[model samples]
Target: MTEIIDGNAVASQIRDDLTAAIETLADAGARPGLATVLMGDDPASQTYVNMKQRDCEEVGIESHHVDVDGDASPAELYDAIADLNEDPDVHGYIVQAPVPDHVDYREVIRRVDPIKDVDGFHPENVGRLVAGDARFRPCTPHGIQKLLETAGVEPEGKDVTIVGRSDIVGKPLANLLIQKAEDGNATVTVCHSRTDDLGAKTRSADIVVAAVGVPELIDGSMIGEGAVVIDVGVNRVDVSERRSEDSQTASDQSDTEKGYELVGDVEFESAKEKASAITPVPGGVGPMTRAMLLYNTVKAASLQEDVAVDLP
Candidate 1:
């Protein structure tokens, strides 16, 4: 039987540890605060921001929600970031991504102060990551690293194949795994849309990371026996029954209302049987992402408080 990599369980463990750490900070007159800049009414972005706020409350971290309109101008967005940058009380903050088409993401990301950049999206933070300096590691990649560590699946001296070459997950993650650190040092291979013979590379890997953003892109046939598969894609698919359900709704004008459901790049059911271990879609990487945000906030506070922390 294949072992399920329980991301929720692992994330809970990290949250618990961070909660205790927060309590310790509170005793010393230090309280960590996370400010989230949410622009637009993107339902998914709102849900993600809400989850981050809820997680902050659970860990005794203060959260401030800065709501802005989707139609807000680039200058307006930059003004908000500038305000947060000057706020000494705010330890860390993240500007929810996919800002309205009008707002430039690159410019907004550049405006955030590197120290308060919990998302690690700023160029300074990215540079620090590449330089092996511990400022703030990108949350998603850090979470993935934790998943591997908590599962006791060391990457060292192993063939680690990662699909997708995005800065957020693939590239930064590869940098971390291939670093000369204890948790990393793996032989890394990155594949993207341009890559040929994808399965040939995946089937030879001891561990496979799927982040191609397409559902069921990888099946059992593409994986090596006993390989560890980490599914990072969150694609929505509409099934027959779901389509029927959407037809009953009053505002269901779209062609497919009831059809979509979150699925990973890998075919979970079939891939599970072939792989030694696998992470499930809904419960995997998602929780870990939020947990790592809290970890980053705590670290940000520690740095501000002049307290040293050992981070991987």
Candidate 2:
């Protein structure tokens, strides 16, 4: 059996470091604050934003939550973000994802000031990321980097196959991997839905990143021997009757009643048997995502100082 890379333990270590850093900032009379604008009642988004708020408390940072209804007009949403952008107390802010269908989500991203865009959705930050400037990295991909570092699977000179091309993960990670740094300098191949014979590319990788949302997309056969697999997908799927019955803890039983549970793109049990290392879904990249979010928040706050961008 391959080693399980425990992201929760790693994220906890990061949070401890962040707590001390925030104390120093507080001593300097700069209280770092994060403002989150969440439109709609997306259960997953709400949970994610709430966890971020909880993390803020852990690190002695203040978080403001602005909840809007699903039908909130784009103008109303933009106005709220504008207000948060101007707030001196708010060092960074993120407008939660999957805004209502009628709202132009990209416009909302465009409206956020780059300096205050902790999520790195603004084009300015995105451009900076692509230019290899030390700026905010999208949280999830940054979390994956941390995982790889903590696991000692440095990407340098390795063949990394990224199985998605979204601006958030695949595209940015591709740039990050090839950057001239210790954790980077990997020869990266990005595969997507349009890529032919996907397994052929994946089976050759020293590192495999499964960010495509399809469940069990990368089986044991697709993973190269001794490869490090990062499963970034969080897909909700209907559970089997036997599996649900076996998941008998009160909380899990309740979850089964709710219709579906979370599963990653790589099937955990099978992938664990094949890869040299792998990240499990719920406990893996999820917590690290929030840790990297806090990291970005601090970086945004520090931008007011003369510290150089220390991007990896």
Q: Write the per-residue lDDT of candidate 1 for residues 1-312, one digit (tens) a residue.
A: 888999999999898877767877777778899999999999999998999999999889999989988887888888889999998778999999989888889989999999999999899999888888858888888888888887889999999999999988999999999999987889999999999999999999999999879888999999999999999888887655444663555544342454456779999988998898899998988788889999999999888887654433
lDDT of 1: 0.87
Relative to the true structure, how large is the alpha-carbon lDDT of every model? 0.87, 0.86
Q: Which whole-number lDDT from 0 to 100 does residue 307 have in model 2?
A: 39
Candidate 2's displacement at residue 98, Å, is: 0.7
lDDT string for model 2 (10-83, tens) is 99998887876676677777768898889999998998888889999888888888988888678889889889
Q: After superposition, how far is residue 32 of candidate 2 from its true place, in Å?
A: 0.6
TM-score of 2: 0.93
Best by lDDT: 1
